[model samples]
Target: EADIYQTPRYLVIGTGKKITLECSQTMGHDKMYWYQQDPGMELHLIHYSYGVNSTEKGDLSSESTVSRIRTEHFPLTLESARPSHTSQYLCASTGETQYFGPGTRLLVL
Candidate 1:
């Protein structure tokens, strides 16, 4: 099983603040994904990468961007956060099976 971890489990920030949600996995998984979800809403894939240095935006349009500099690291960055960006950000890495991090809940004031 991949040990995925997300930092700042909960965040509360004022609008227009730039934030980066950190996601890391202990296991070396080539496929990684980032998803966004509002309370009680279904998860929407925002970004994904096939491997290090390969990234692609997901179906849902988002203001944030993601980069995979290393096989075990895929971080999502929001240049300027807004209230509408408030939601839970989930990170997952897939081997034979997909494993997810605890997720980061963000609130922009």
Candidate 2:
């Protein structure tokens, strides 16, 4: 409901393959967040940004890195994907309220 969109709604890739998860919002929010979740599990915050040029790692440690080059776009990149990295990635933005994208489901074989 956040007017946010995530690309590659589903993906299956081999181990060691580098991949990027794309997230974008049209609401012009200054705060954005990324979370990782497994099936029937709680979401873990992996990254967040207060605004453009300002990013911070979340409570959860992640091998993936993120960038906030623009206000509407926040992409997470995995230099090398692994089976352990397999999980669903969620993108969210906040103003007075939080909005979340549909999420991207990734599976590393």
Candidate 3:
């Protein structure tokens, strides 16, 4: 089973606010990823990490940042929250296959 976790499964934030979505995995997988899902169910890669101190933005456009200081932790930060940033964020870890955490759904108004 996957040992990954995400806090505040649902969030309602005002526009211009700052929000941090927490993501952590106890599996020690070196590869961690974050994907953004639209309301219509289209998913897009937004950020990823390939081990400690290694992080890169994914294919999609995102205003968030990610950091990997410890192997079991990868957190995403949005400096300013907006209604455009309202979406479901999914965190995942990969070995031979990917294991996902329960997604965090954010609604910025």
Residues 1-109, model 2: lDDT tens digits? 5589999899999999999999999999999999999999999999999999999999999999999999999999999999999999999999999899999999999
State the lDDT of candidate 3 residue by residue for 1-109, as single tens digits: 7899998899999999988999999887999999999877877999999999999999998999999999999999999999999899999999888999999999999
Tens digit of lDDT per residue, candidate 1, span 8-108? 89999999899999999988889999999898999999999999899999989999999998898999999999999999999999999989999999999
Top TM-score hit: 2
Looking at candidate 3, the ten consecutive residues that score lowest on lDDT are 37-46
RMSD, model 2, all Cα superposed? Answer: 0.7
Off by over 4 Å in 3: none
Task: Tally clashes: model 3.
Answer: 0
Deviation of model 2 at 41, angstroms: 0.6
Candidate 2 structure lDDT: 0.96
lDDT (0 to 1) per candidate? 0.94, 0.96, 0.94
Which regions of candidate 1 are displaced past 4 Å?
Answer: none
Q: What is the full ranking by lDDT, best candidate first?
A: 2, 1, 3
